[model samples]
Target: MAKTQYYTATSIDGYIADANNSLDWLFEVDEGTANPFGEFFAGVGAFAMGATTYEWVLENDNLLEEPQNWHDMYGEVPCWVFTHRDLPPVPDANVFMISGDVRRVHEAMLVAAQGKNVWLAGGGDLVAQFAQQGLLDEIILGIAPAVLGEGTPLLRHKLHVDELILTGVREVGQFAYLTYAVGDVARMGRHLAAETATLLPVNF
Candidate 1:
């Protein structure tokens, strides 16, 4: 079955980017001979990203001056960028700028993905919305050896330990890769509701 996955790198301190919103620290890490991202991305027929992530890639990769970079990385896979503002598109790339509910976009992504999995290329907050909606199924994190005192978080939402099942763990150079299978949304909702009920004050 096709699963919705959030695959991204993070610092040891659980930040994706530094205070400056820069990923320069990530590139400084020693990547082993084998990069597993290509393999993971192969199964992704469609992907979505928040405006910040999209803009970062666009500017950092110089996708405007060199649109081929986008092709080389993602190929012809459709990308939906969640942004309310007007952002320039990469030439010759299947990029869509959209806003509003993630549920509708998720449906479109599923249809576009066909039998393939959907990837959530995120900026934390965006992925949290998907998780809240029960659209996110898996989380793959490449934990790098770095600590940013304050920066963009890995995920904006609070996920209980019981909600995640560790499926795989591997070490690649200085990075530790961890794969987690998220619990179903329905069950998660029930758990959250139960917790909320416990927190409610009882009448004297």
Candidate 2:
């Protein structure tokens, strides 16, 4: 089964991005310290993000030109960008733009994932939509020390009760990274053996 996961950084107040949808706050990380997110980043097989995040990465950094070692690993992995407006494609072979129903985009992502993990690369609105539909399988958040008074929240809506289980936590400098696994929804179904056991009278 394909598991969908989100890897994002949040402010102390739980904002993932600023009002302008910028991640300027995230760039303040201590360069000397080891990154706690390396493990999670290594595990992702594919990345999915909204158009805005994709555009920001390309324009802000010469990311498209100067390829880093991270690209050596992530470059081969498919990057699906959700966009309504058409834009020039990334020069790399791994990046692709998708415009369609969110559900369809997700389905295509799963197919492309091919048993590998699918990463939700930020954009709370997109993440919320997947969570609402019970399609999101995991959430991994890196909480930065700074707080933004107002910005884009980590999640926009309430999910089903007991829907998440914390798997691990790591501290890197002033930031704390947390990982959660989505509870299984299919477990709610009753099996034939369980039904038969329920029907049988209790032994006196």
Candidate with best TM-score = 1
Report lDDT (Cα) of residue 110, candidate 1. Answer: 97
| lDDT, residue 129, candidate 1 | 98
What would the per-residue lDDT of candidate 1 be over residues 56-175, giving only the tens digit for each residue? Answer: 999999999999999999999999999989999999999999999999999999999999999998989999999899788999999999988999999998888777877789999999
Q: How does each model score on lDDT? A: 0.93, 0.75
> Model 1: C-alpha RMSD to truth?
7.3
Residue-level lDDT of model 2, residues 1-204, one tens digit each, is 567888888988989888888888788865337855566666667778887777777777656575463375465778888888886665655888876666777787787777778899868887877777778888888888878898888888676556766777987777788888774632232243478889999988
Q: Number of clashing pairs, model 2?
A: 0
The residue pairs that clash in candidate 1, if any, are: none
Q: What global local distance difference test value does model 1 have?
A: 0.93
Candidate 2, overall lDDT? 0.75
Taking all chains together, each candidate's TM-score versus the true structure is 0.90, 0.80
